[model samples]
Target: MKNFVFSEAVVMAGLRWTIVLIFMLFGLAKFAEYEAAGVAKIAAHYPLFAWMYPLWGESGASNVIGTIELLTGAMIAVGAFSARASFVGGLMGIFTFCVTLSFALGAPAFWEAGYGAPFLGSTGQFLVKDAVLLAACFAIMVDGLRRHTAP
Candidate 1:
């Protein structure tokens, strides 16, 4: 029984850290524009976002996305308000997933041209990673709520 409890605790801790690391790396990459050129190269291939580049410009979009990433990462890392952070993160993940899905589905012509094929790869990666992160956030929220209300 004791060993089982310890194992569960360890798993929980690992899950928490995994979520934190995901957010941290995501924020850092965005902030540094670590692969901005590559991302822009992919985006350029997409017809949907062709207008976005002209509207916001790559630098502006990067800055905005970076800010959101940093804030979300910090909120999760602090963990002081775990429930709130988890809720926010989960919602953000859902929103991101939806947006990426839309781009993936709506830009077939771009893909057919071969210019946007790389974006499909990147979007697939984002969907997988975000889905896992969303699950983690939901678990954290449920666990935190249960603990708070436990008799």
Candidate 2:
């Protein structure tokens, strides 16, 4: 047991679970009016999601996204059985944040405040932080792929 490197294992496991928790909590929150409304406001400015309102409406779309997030979190928590799940979840996270980050381009109000490139407002800063999570998700995906393909 002395040779086992328990500290590294603990840190890795903690990071994985942290990713899982983030998705799960936000996924669950998507059902709430406040959360769903907030998502709608930003999604409105995202051109990629423009078709969403006409098809399923904001609440419906949010619930669908919530289901995806909840499933992603549950799958991430599955350890070895999570190989494909984590990869897909990571891709999903990357997609979500890419759209979120685009707000810097799509929303002029973000720049009109004189906050400059960094986006000084709470909402602007909130989307900016997703870049860190996006990178972490990529790392999770790479690790999962390595484990899956290892001999």
Candidate 3:
């Protein structure tokens, strides 16, 4: 039982690192003009996020998001050793995915109508992956909480 539990921990660590690398790479990409422009188009459609355009413009909003991703990734990486840090990182991940997933609703032609209502188009395919990422974040949150509370 103990060995099995330990194995699970090892697997979760690998998952954590995967999410961290994702954050790092995507965070870095946010700094580019093309990436910034793309995100701006999406954010412009999101009512909750649309206000950012007026306040910060495209580049500024993207930079802010990139900074959040970088910070969240750093925290999760440090979480390899610290349960509390992982908890915080998990929270950040939850928030990050929540926003991105919302993008799917308003994204033009997100559904591949040729197949059916449930079938997804190219943009939907990309956005749907966040559901898995969101689940992983939840697992990280639970694992971190468990580790922090354990004697």
Candidate 4:
């Protein structure tokens, strides 16, 4: 059990699939009207994403994001066999998570009412988990680079 848990190959595969499934699932969700509207509300609060609403409106913006997520997931899935593919996938994943984490710019308001930090409201909980995913992206990037450059 310990060996399985600690094995580089096993751990790498686990990390790879974890990211793949998350992106895939969330990407698919974006196409739903409820999900798209919810995402729009959150994106509206972030300056960087504000332009998307004007340019694409709600569903269009959501579809754009969903496409990117699906593509990134596909790249990561292909990463299982190709270091270069994995490297690109990791880069995309890093960017994706960074953008999501940027939502933290508005995080204080996301805390449960009458409470503060350490107590998270719904949005706060959703955004904070990206930190772990961001770390995983870094790991994937580093390993991909190492493998790609190995002689």
Candidate number achieving the greatest lDDT relative to the actual structure: 4
Instruction: Name the weakest run of 10 consecutive residues (lDDT summed) in model 1.
Output: 104-113
**Model 1 lDDT per residue over 115-142, tens place:** 5555444445544455566667666656
Model 1 deviation from native, Cα RMSD in Å = 5.1
Could you give candidate 2's per-residue lDDT for residues 1-151 as a string of tens digits?
A: 7787666447657777898899899999988888878888877557777677668888887888789788877767775366676666666666766766877675645643765665466666666777887786777777677767878
Q: What overall lDDT goes with each candidate model?
A: 0.58, 0.73, 0.87, 0.88
The 10 consecutive residues of candidate 2 with the worst lDDT sum are 106-115
How does model 4 score by TM-score?
0.91
TM-score ranking of the models: 4, 3, 2, 1
Best TM-score among the predictions, by candidate number: 4
Question: Tens-digit lDDT track for model 3 on 119-142?
Answer: 998778888999999988888887
Global CA lDDT of candidate 2, please? 0.73
Cα RMSDs, all models: 5.1, 3.1, 2.6, 1.8
Return whichever of 1 and 4 wins on TM-score. Answer: 4
Each candidate's number of clashing pairs is 0, 0, 0, 0
lDDT of 1: 0.58
Determine the backbone clash count of candidate 2: 0
**Residue 13 of model 2, lDDT score:** 72
